[model samples]
Target: MNDCVAWSGGRPVEWLLTNAPVDKHWCTIHATHMTAEEATALAASGAVVGLCPTTEANLGDGLFPFEDYAGAEGNWGVGTDSHVSVSPIAELRLLEYGQRIARQERNIAAGTQDRSTGRALLEHAWAGGSQASGRSTGGLEVGQRADILSLNENHPVLVGRTGDEILDSWIFSGENTPVQNVMVGGKWVIRDGHHEREEEILDNYATVLRRLST
Candidate 1:
């Protein structure tokens, strides 16, 4: 982790001499706190800040410098580091809400092209998550990997909405409606929010927990 700080801290000075971009290929976890200079240098390196918002909130790690990071045009993505909360919506909501609380502004993520805050966050997660995973995906566009989430449009939260409102409701409204299904690599791993082998998986997990406790 010190290595990350060292590299982030030194990038600006180093960039002046080398004229080469610092890599985002292997950066994942970041030390929770970093100096302004370090954050600036790291952002200059084209690295995506790996943020697990739920975990960060639970651990009381200080918030990231969203405005500063935004000013630096830093890349960012989400993760489920501790397995405590795995829902994609929860992570994204926490991410935006955290920023709103820290920056004291509404729609703190507005950006060019992606004007809606929700859309921008989705785009960032889609692009940066794909990059972090070393997979080429995150959109429905042609030639991209087939990863998609299908929602229940008739759900209460989604009723009477179209386009960005739907997305905004999903991320900002604190709805508990689970993902109806998930397709990853053109295969369905979750159907109606229930895993394909959920019962068996839960049984096995319970067995392991029992053994660990005894």
Candidate 2:
């Protein structure tokens, strides 16, 4: 906010939108200060607003205008900005929870009675994330990147849950990760709840941490 106010000369949303590229994203969930006109234009412009709820809460950045942004039919997605929380569940959960708290309402993400809250949030994030990345990885279909997340069907919390219920259980149920496998481009990167190169990755991360700390 301070930076936007200082740098944008009181027209932060317009300045940022004007300067941002059309083919990419306009990030940092700029709706907090956006007017109705700016919100509508941003929605129509088709730039995905990267809303990092966990990071925003961690830094006390302020509440995003969920009603305004979604009301304008905005394209939006979650992110792990500053690495506060890498779990997509955490991001989506907090996004909805934050809105619920702010608006004193429930199921704000679904935006309707018939829609499942978790399902709605997941679809919004999935499509917007793919679009913002400019990648052909949005859905499970031909001509799309084979990006997949397979949940542990045997996980206690997930046992017997089906369809959107599975997503609801995973995202809203507990902290323990239920993802058993992950595949990208038809290759397995995570299986049985472990990354293929976990040890090596941790070792390299420690080395980088030491170097950066020094």
Candidate 3:
């Protein structure tokens, strides 16, 4: 489960395809070297692929075949591996941008007619991430945890945006975080764009960094 940077070439994919326990085990195949056939097979096997675009690019990993992965109807989600980037928005932005650059096309991640690239990416990632974590999350449902985010409507990138366009603007155009509030399990952990324990958390984090540097 959640194998970091599991490159998808050579024998790794084959082994995973043949040996991975069904419905109980999933791999986070980095997929930089993944082939189309391998992707299709992984889709058929119902394995989850973890695409960490920020870390992959920082480490010079090859571009993932995102279009092919989507075409095969593969299960996938974004990750922020290695602490290089922490925001889910940035991870998503880079994921779509990488695909656009490689294919020289706009909205490569849309994958279907009338689908918003941002919304599609968000839903896929949320679903796959929920499955990976074995949680009843990823959507607002009757039994799921009450995890929610409130975007800042007044943010410059969000002006005049609505529906899926809001997600698109936040992912592709916003320079700063647009999440104004966050709640988990019916409790507000973040409000007015500030974490509830920000000051104390930063103080402890700085102490640890100082100790490590010494």
Candidate 4:
């Protein structure tokens, strides 16, 4: 009880599950290092399991019980903790592979009819990411956030792919900067593989990091 209370920031998961503010969206972090019971409890509370794949693998964090979570129809998403890597595909593949290595089972993460583990991984991460971030994104289905990544189809890493294969290649293969463009908040943030404010953004970040170090 104490752990659950403390884990939930003094409020019980039941409270969050029932009385979550309609206006102020909420998401839980560091949902790793939990028991199966705790994981199930969190799923029941409508919290998205925030998976940080690269950091987890780097730090040797054990595999998350994604199978159990998915069995419960739990919401989940990904993050770039430590920023050591930044690609949705790597995140997804690492997540699934972690499960596979643990269970020594294939297709344990498919979750439902007609769902490939790869596709499920991508959909869950992207959609749950937007939900966790209090935004509406993840696809081109209309009326969602304009934040989008345009892949370089001609890139060798992405050549000879379509559908889930494109996503699979993107996640598994070391395809970098093949992202030709990105838009955020209905504006072009990256034009021709460069941030519109690249120089300024980099300058500000450098300034902040240097100041913090001293």
Each candidate structure's count of clashing pairs: 0, 0, 0, 1
Per-residue lDDT, model 4, residue 179, is 81
CA displacement after TM-score superposition, residue 143 of candidate 1 (Å): 2.6
Q: Which candidate is the best by TM-score?
A: 3
**lDDT (0-100) at residue 177 of candidate 1?**
74
Candidate 4 at residue 141, lDDT? 72
Off by over 4 Å in 4: 1-25, 111-115, 175-177, 203-214
lDDT of 4 by residue, 1-214 (tens): 3786776654454444445542224576546665566567777667676788778788876677776677777788888887678776777778877887888877556755465666767788877898798888988878888888898899887898988777667766764646888888888888788988899999999999999999
Stretches of candidate 2 above 4 Å error? 18-31, 210-214
Per-residue CA lDDT of model 1 for 1-214, tens digit only, reads 4564377754433433245555777454643466566667777777777777788888887776667767788788887887689867788888778887876767777754447878888888888888788888987888889988888888888889799888888887775773689898999999988889999999999999999999
Rank the candidate models, highest TM-score first.
3, 2, 1, 4
lDDT of 3 by residue, 44-79 (tens): 777788888888888887788776777888888777
TM-score, structure 1 vs. true: 0.83
> For each candidate, what is the lDDT?
0.75, 0.82, 0.79, 0.73
The whole-model C-alpha lDDT of candidate 2 against the native structure comes to 0.82
TM-score of each: 0.83, 0.89, 0.89, 0.77
The total of clashing pairs for model 3 equals 0
Winner of 1 and 2 under TM-score: 2
lDDT of 1 at 100: 79
Candidate 4, after superposition: displacement of residue 38 in Å?
2.4
Which of the predicted structures, 2 or 3, would earn the higher lDDT when compared with the native?
Answer: 2
